[model samples]
Target: MRGVGIEVNEEKVGRTMEVDEKSVSGTRFCLLLSPDRMRGSLCLRLERFRPRLGSLPGRRQRVCAQRRSPRARRETSPARWRLKRMSPSPAVVVLALLLAQHPSADTLRVPLDYTSIQEAIVAADDGDTVLVWPGTYNERVDFLGKAVAVVGREGAQVTVIDGGGSGPVVTFGSAEPPGARLEGFTVMNGNYNVQLRGGGILCSAGATPVLIHNIVSDNVANYSGGGIACLGSSPFIIANTIVRNRARPFGAIGDGLGGGIACDGGAPTIVANVIEENIAGGTGLSGGGGIACYGGSHPRIDNNAIRHNVAWSTYGLAWGGGVFCTDASHPNITGNSLLENHVQSQTVEEGGAIYCFDSSSPLIRENAIRGHTSGSGGAVHTSNGSEPTLVLNNIEGNDPYGLVNDEPGVTLCAVNNWWGAVSGPYHPETNPGGDGDPVSDGVAFAPWLASAERLVFVRGWPEACRVRQGGDLRVELAVFNRMPGFQRFWFVTSVDLPGGASFGPLAGPTPLMLLPDGMMSGILGHAIPPDAPTGLWTYHASIGIPPHDTLDHAQFDFEVTAAVQRLLRSRSLDCLFPSP
Candidate 1:
């Protein structure tokens, strides 16, 4: 194929030309014109003679030469037609198909085998995926400015960052829209595990929220939250086993708080996690053996197994064995099993299971508490005018050292606790009462203390039940009437008598406070008024035999037919009714 360039010269149009390269390149048409558009009338005439060139100058060569054309008085400028070989349509279609087959989320993937986790993070663009492979990257990683998803393969031990040294393992501080997501990795060893402020792993005031899962354990915090710390951020600590993290102070008052994790003022959800064997050791004032909730931080500690931890006198004063909620911080302590927790020192003021003070009312209920020890409450204690501590369904063992409430107006109303020696107002044997049928043969009826095992017998009497005139009369009744253990007895009475017949100075119900014998009796003396009328009168009485420690009810009915019968009987009754 061949082509030629016929330069056109006209007065109004610049020296312009057209090139048709179908002969040399074997396809298509070509065109070129002067660089200057002004005085462009002459350049338009050159289009009439469509010239072609066999070879066109390169772009660099076309700019160098420019001359005025004499033919037809044309304006000359630099613009040339350059042509090269072009590919067929079938070849262009094949290249686009290859790129579409590869997988990508509007970005690229970088492996951790050859590069560092921080290097992959920094090199990634927004919306890219950095697939980290299996290996330990023993260094602190910070998500510099990328809003990318940095994930690792499952069972791929790719990025194993430690707390051995060099500050927090990962940090996220950026102005991106929606922060970041961290999943499928084992994060351990650091002064603090994952610290982020807003952007990625927030440690800042308005840094973004974090979602943590899959075992964050054995981490230490010099201040609080040994496993993870969300300073002012609210993170969702969901379904993770946070175990054995210690928070001890090296400087200042080492008031260690929250061994497993300490959330300071940040309202995070600590749900369904097993927080145990965690110690908050202090040299001075420590709190929350398993988890400490302080500083007006209201955290909901629900449905977790907080057991076998020690919040004791590690320092001068220690408190909160299983969980410590103080400082007027109202945490909802519900559905948690707080068992076998110990507050060893009397100097540790409150709560073997929980210590509440300073007007903080935490809802403590439905928890199985046992084998716990402290100065006051085996279960719980409150003080500082913090009235109405709601405690319900907590099991109390006879802990020699248990919960104590020293403040006035502190009401601890406990119910349904299963221990023989529970200290309260009601006696264990007297509860589950049987109306005057007191001989209950249950194990709970045994002596409350080992030293005093007094006999409690069933008092059975007053069966028919009728009385009047204050039932001032006395009667004697006995059961197994001559029992040897019951050597002494007393008369107790109830009567229905007319108003005129007065049983003067009638016997009281407990007049015979102790009846040592089985048979003993007292008189029911009556005074008949001189002008009294006739009326039907009935008398009933019973005997309380203290030896048997039982009441024997016997009914004795008699009608005072007339006033004369009572007057005559009073004189005759002296002979029949002798004080027995």
Candidate 2:
């Protein structure tokens, strides 16, 4: 006969078990084990004990025991043990310890464990993931200085954080480091006053959080930054769609600005965002319908599409329909597309695409500023001793002028830009009744290129020149000598083809000599593959004249069609073709 005893210790609860094997027959013992205080219940199976035949009377027997936890049934290790069974010498018992498995960083689920996001955040420690399910949460969440990630389980389209027209949607003001991340949510309907900026998300006081893959829209602010406002912080704002936000009017002073994003003494990296249809509404000096920078904020604004934003003022001047920089803010605005932004005011307005004021020296480069309309400086306006260096930009198709300097003594140094024309039709030279040469007045538009060498013109092609997917596209270009006197020039024809389009040997920077009024022409051939995507394609051509100068350029658009067999059956093509 044998007796077994078991004990379990769980925080404040304790349990004991005692088993007597004397009543069992054939040396077999049936023991039922249940440890409820542990994370999982365990079951024990002991094989029949076999004693030595010719040994002493109290000889011990070997028993095989297998332990299986209810929760670890699918992942149990094959380590069953063989122990000595209880004999008349002493009661031999086995104690199995089950240690709980703890993860390094726990994932707290929303609505399953915690009812709300803020509740999960409050209960979670640092280095935890508060994952919210797909739904609209109308509460305002703050990081509360924790280095945690509050992310949506799904994407931004289904997971939303609506503020219900109250405070900011999310704030990272406790100086949270870059490890604190807020991703995959549509934050909207946030309203704030001047003291509390950043309607969508506020990263202030040197707190730098990673804000990625979010749609911050329809937020409002009384003073500035209706969508996202930053003050003395450097956050990485990337790949967000900020639209339809408003900096509303308050009181008599028109101080509302930065309808999409506002920065004050911060150096945030704003990249790859779509800021559109935002409004900065006020009465005096209302500006920056898309982005506003003030108080020496040097933001890196790159690779963004800013369009259709408006700056409206009824009593004072309006500036910067697309982007506004003032008060010594030196931002590097590069590789952006600013289009269709407007400033509506009964008083004076300037800078339909970009405005710089109060000695703000911004470097505007490689941007396409078009379709902007303002009372002055239809594409770019500069005033109050602001010196902006415009280089390698395509500023064309603006409403009134290409560039304007509103102040009389300020001279805008616009060098090496394509202003929709090959001749001298810029500001101050075309200021009402001025000469056709360079003037040292409001705008300095000399040394401009004769023609847009970056624009390639394909003559007699339809609006979308259709080409078969597995077919050839033949482009003909006519290069004219627009410069004075007989000059020797080299013309290079290149194609910015769509995917799967290969260039043939016919395309080249072929050498040619022209008389005073001569015209030379060439043909370019391309072989688009069978798997080419059906879309619009653009072809570019450049004419290189003398010492390091590309004077004339043109751009042509064409479309690739998927019906290659039908086009081949209709007509016999002669140019380059795909592989047979």
In terms of TM-score, the best-performing candidate is: 2
TM-score of each: 0.48, 0.59
Write the residue-wise lDDT of candidate 2 on 307-423 in tens digits.
Answer: 889998988878899999999999999767687899988988878889899989899976767777887555688878788988777677777767776677666777776666666
Q: Which stretches of candidate 1 lie over 4 Å from their true place?
A: 1-114, 120-132, 142-152, 155-159, 170-179, 192-208, 344-346, 375-377, 385-403, 412-580
Q: Where in model 2 is the C-alpha error above 4 Å?
A: 1-103, 193-195, 407-410, 427-440, 450-580
- Candidate 1, residues 265-287, lDDT tens digits: the string is 65555544556667676677666
Model 2: which ten-residue window has the lowest total lDDT?
90-99
